[model samples]
Target: MTSTLILGGRRSGKSARAQALASTFAEVTLIATATASDGEMAERITRHQADRPAHWHTVESPLYLASALQQADAAGCCLLVDCLTLWQTNLLLAEDETLLARETDALLAILPRLQAEVILVSNEVGWSIVPESALARRFADEVGRLHQRLAAACQRVELVVAGLPLTMKNETGTR
Candidate 1:
């Protein structure tokens, strides 16, 4: 299956780009990695859900992303994973110390074998200044390393900024 990784800063149109790319497919499954832990977050999730096409199937995968992807994959269908950073945050805060590496490894292992077209959205956090807190620093570092590995595994990689997309890597070598 063809796969692409879309990276961008906050509100940089990464999710929009992923949606546009997946629009070509006949069937779409949006695997969301967000949980409404607070009132503000609940509002944000509601807004995001309202923005997406109602016809698209939605799967809530706050932690076990790989398993969700596996269950949702279909031939000729498109699977869009909106934002991995949230997923990272969920893993980071989990009580199970081994959960992070286990889930991440599962995701990487399954990406190459999926039948559906894959479009992944992730925040580009490497550009910002280092965080003061150790947890924040670890989060940044983990996200950066995850992006690198995902980029290498994916067939195409694009960076979005100001609602514009720039292809960073394309195995097809075409514009």
Candidate 2:
């Protein structure tokens, strides 16, 4: 079956919902896109790691997410990418934007061929006001565009608000 996309604002319960959905699968693999570059980020990553079930396998990939997905697919594992926003941040900061674009394209192209269930979680950044700084604005735009593309790629799409989920694109076995 094809994967699903869960989009929501920060702390809007998107990750929680994704985790719940992932639990249905026999083998769950978490693809972590966050990198610990600073103390705050490290703490955040720690908290996220603590929140997840101990049995779920975790793979840290701040870049080359498409390759990680392929690995998960090869293992016949259900995959949950907790947040795309952080991955976007990592890409934007990278010196090579071309690599980011290539990786994203590869990810989109490979998703349909994969056998495992996949759940992609991303922030709804377009709902907020325009960012003040140029870098922030660019990051927002990139993330928003990525979210749009992934949402279309998925078989099911859901928007979470106030910890409640509203299905945007409903599909069988998604409830």
Worst 10 residues of 1 by lDDT: 166-175
lDDT top scorer: 1
Which regions of candidate 2 fall more than 4 Å away from where they truly are? 74-76, 173-175
lDDT of 2 by residue, 1-175 (tens): 6689999998899988998888877789999999888999899889888888899999998888888988877445688997888888888889996877887888899888888888999999988899999999999888878888887788899999999999999765645
> What tens digits encode model 1's per-residue C-alpha lDDT throughout 71-138?
99999999999879999999999999999999999999999999999999999998989999999999
Badly placed stretches (over 4 Å) of model 1 are: none
In candidate 2, how many Å is residue 32 off? 0.3
- Give the C-alpha miss distance for residue 159 in model 2, angstroms: 0.7
Candidate 1 C-alpha RMSD relative to the actual structure: 0.9
Model 1 Cα displacement at 58 (Å)? Answer: 0.4
* Model 1 per-residue lDDT at 153: 96
- What's model 1's overall lDDT? 0.94
Q: In model 1, how large is the Cα lDDT of residue 24?
A: 86
Candidate 1, pairs of clashing residues? none
